[model samples]
Structures are given as structure tokens and as C-alpha cells.
Target: MRLNGKLAIVTAAASGMGRAGVARFVREGAKVAAIDISAEALEGVVAEFGADTVTGIRADLLNPDDATGSIDQAVEWLGGADILWAHAGMPGPASVENLDLDAYRKAIDLNITSAALGAGRVAQHMRKRGGGSIIFTSSVSGLVGSMMSPIYSAAKWGVVGLTKSLALALAGDGIRVNVVCPGLADTPMKTGFTGRSGDPAEAAANEAKLIANVPMGRLVQAGEIADAALWLASDEASFVTGVALPVDGGFTAR
Candidate 1:
């Protein structure tokens, strides 16, 4: 119960790492406001976690108002937020040759602006509460260049920058800001983006290629990434801030 008595707000909480983080936070004794764009999915999360431990909010974070609104709603319900996980992001269109300008813009909005905006809003409430922890999700692409997804790489790089800057900005208020960069993960996001096939031969080829660059010989898991976030949100990392911790199975090491 590292996070006992804490209140947290997590974006993109309906699936993948965000959903895992919500569950982890709850297990550690934090009341979570799970914000996602899918109303039905949020309902499912509420059902799984029970209304007492989690409150689901359907919000399109692309709209600036909705991003901050989600945090405000958490404050109203949970009283105030001590842990802010700005974990919402989209891979966008991973085309480099025929760069999709629209996709790039949307990626920036979803991955960079949304995280920064949400963290800023939550920081205010945390400041009033005396202290807090703010965690953002970046990617291994943030530390190194991504050949297949330039726009996503740029957006995640922006997250790292934002986290460092915010850490210094909010340090005086006792708010710690950090980022977690995950390597290829076996999550709904990864499967959806890769279009994983059921064919045995194709699946083998895909798995091989996916782990080729990972020194650890396997993909990271959503739960592992959640553990990193949990540590950052807990008192164990009380003196940790402005750090970009990569939970990427050594992907960025090589």
C-alpha cells in the first residue's frame, strides 16, 4: 500500500498501460479517476474496479477543455489529486515517406500538448495540497530516433522535455515530475498498431522482428511499465524528479 490515502487521476485509463496503472494505483490504495475517450470502455473499468475505488470519465482529450476538465472532475470527487499520470497518447500514422501532416498534428495534440496541459492543471491542485507526484509516459523513441515513426518520436521527445522542465518548475511546490519510456510492449496499443495476425508463420515473423532490436530478447509488458509509474508515484521516489526512466527491456541501451 505504497500509495495509501492518495488520490490519482490517470488519462487514457480505458486500456493498455493506462488501464494497468489504474489497477496498480488502486491496489496500492489510491482512489483513481480513470479518464478515457470511450464511454463504454470507461464503464467496463468502473465495473471491474468497482465505483468506490475508481470513477470513469469519458473525455476526448484532444479538446483542451476536456483534458483539464477531467482533472477538475477528479478533484471534485476525490477531493484533490496527489498523483497525476498523464499517460494518454496515440502512435498516429507511422508513415515517414508520405508524412501525414494531419496525423502529425493529432499526434502532437494527443501526446505532447495533452500531457503538458493536464500535468499543468493537476500541478495547481497538488501545489495546494503541499506535495504530489506527476508521471508522464514517453517511449524509447524519445531517447533515440525512430526510423518508422518520426512524428511519434518527436512527440515523445517533447514529453521528456516537458517532464524535465516541469520537474524544475514544480519542485518548489513539492511536486515531482518524471517520465517513463517503455520499449515495445505486448499491449492492445502495440497489437492494434502492428496489426498482429493470427497466422502462425506471420506471427512468428512479426515477433522475431519486434524483439530483434531488444537486447532482452522480448517485449516489455504493460504491467512492468505500470510498476515503474507506481514507484514514481510512491514515497520510495520522494527525492526523484525530472528523470526519464526507461522501462524498455534495454531497447535504448543498444
Candidate 2:
């Protein structure tokens, strides 16, 4: 077990990449506290993974109190946190032209602000334990412009900046901070962003458009991205820090 005797906290853990990440970490022998905004989904995770291994918490990362409180709750439940994956995110409102100002603010808050807040709170906890790893989920959109979602790209780019600066700030404390820039993945956010209708033909067309651009010729799987997260969280990546790792199947290389 790569993470045996470790305690991990994963945000947005009810579905998609977050859920897969929580499961991956637990499988590596970590006691994980999984957090999501949906209480029902959290309950489902608990039932599927068992309360002994996964502790589920309902938390809205956009809420200031909830953002920091989730870390506190996880520490209380899991005893301590050796790894923190701040991975909650949203697609925001379609394009920049149709961007809802309120939703844009929320998208920024959820994608970047909450990540910073969570990291700060978690850092405090990890400091007592001597050190820990903190990984933030960014996107290939952060590395390149996206005509479909500008605000989301902006927020992810912000994550890259935050991760580097935090790594330097926490280095003396033995903490490592890094960002994962995943390409198009088979996740709920991907479906919500690209899907326009329930029509099968329309869905296939949407997927085809994205696949054509990917160097791998298909969308990445959620578990694949979680694998990157696991490596960053594990001791295998001990010397790695302040990196924007593109788990994007060479999409950004083009």
C-alpha cells in the first residue's frame, strides 16, 4: 500500500474525478474523509466504501465557512490529514459572452478561492504532523485558451499560480504543493459542459469534436486522472513540488 497509515481528505468526492480519487487513496491504504455538496451522494459513498474506510461530509466549497470547516471536520473524523486534494469545481456559465456575473464569481470562488482556503486550513493541520502533500486540480484549459469556457480556464490558471507560491511558502515546513492539469476527462463536468441535448447523435457529435483535438484521440478517464493525484499524494513523489503536471495525454503539447 503506497499510502498505508495515512489520512487523506478529498473534496468533491461524491462523483467524477473526486470520487475516483477518494476511492484510489483508500485503496492505497489511507483512511479518507470524502466531501461533497450533496448529502445523499456522500451517504452513497459511505455505503459503497464503508464508514470505516471513508468518512463522508456534505460541504459546499463555495461557502467561506464550509470551505475551511470541511478541513476541520476531516481532521476530526480522520484523526489527521497527511494528504489534501482540493478538487471541487464547476464549468461556470457556458461562454464568456453569456457569462452570468454571479455565476462567474461563484465559479472563481469554487475553483480557486476555496482551494486556497482549504489548503491554508489543511496546512495548519499538517504542520503539526511535520509535513503533508497538497494537490489542486487544474485543467488543460489553464495551460491554453478555451473558446468554450474562458472563466474556467482563468480560474484553473489561478490554481497553477497558487500551487507554485504555496509550495515555496510551505517548503520549509516540509509540505509539498502541486497542481494537476487534466485534459478532457469522462467526468460529470465534462458531460455538463459539452452536452446540449439528450439526443444520442448530438452527444456523439459533441464527444467527437473533443476527441478530434486530443492527441490520445479520446477523453481521459476519471481513474486515470485519479492515478496522477495518487502519485502526487504518495511518498513516491517525495521530491516533487510546485509542479503543474499535465495529465492531458499530450493535448497541451500540441
* Residue-by-residue lDDT tens digits, candidate 2, 1-254: 99999999999999999999988998999999998999999999999889899989889888999999989999999998899999988877667776689999999999999999999999999999999999999999888987767888899999999999999999999999999999988877776567635576776787788788888787899999899999999999999999999988788887
Query: Could you give candidate 1's per-residue lDDT for residues 3-27 as a string of tens digits?
Result: 9999999999998899999999999
TM per model? 0.94, 0.96
TM-score of 1: 0.94
For every candidate, C-alpha RMSD to the true structure in Å:
2.0, 1.4
Taken over the whole model, the C-alpha lDDT of each candidate is 0.89, 0.91
Cα-based lDDT at residue 19, candidate 2: 91
**Which is the leading candidate under lDDT?**
2
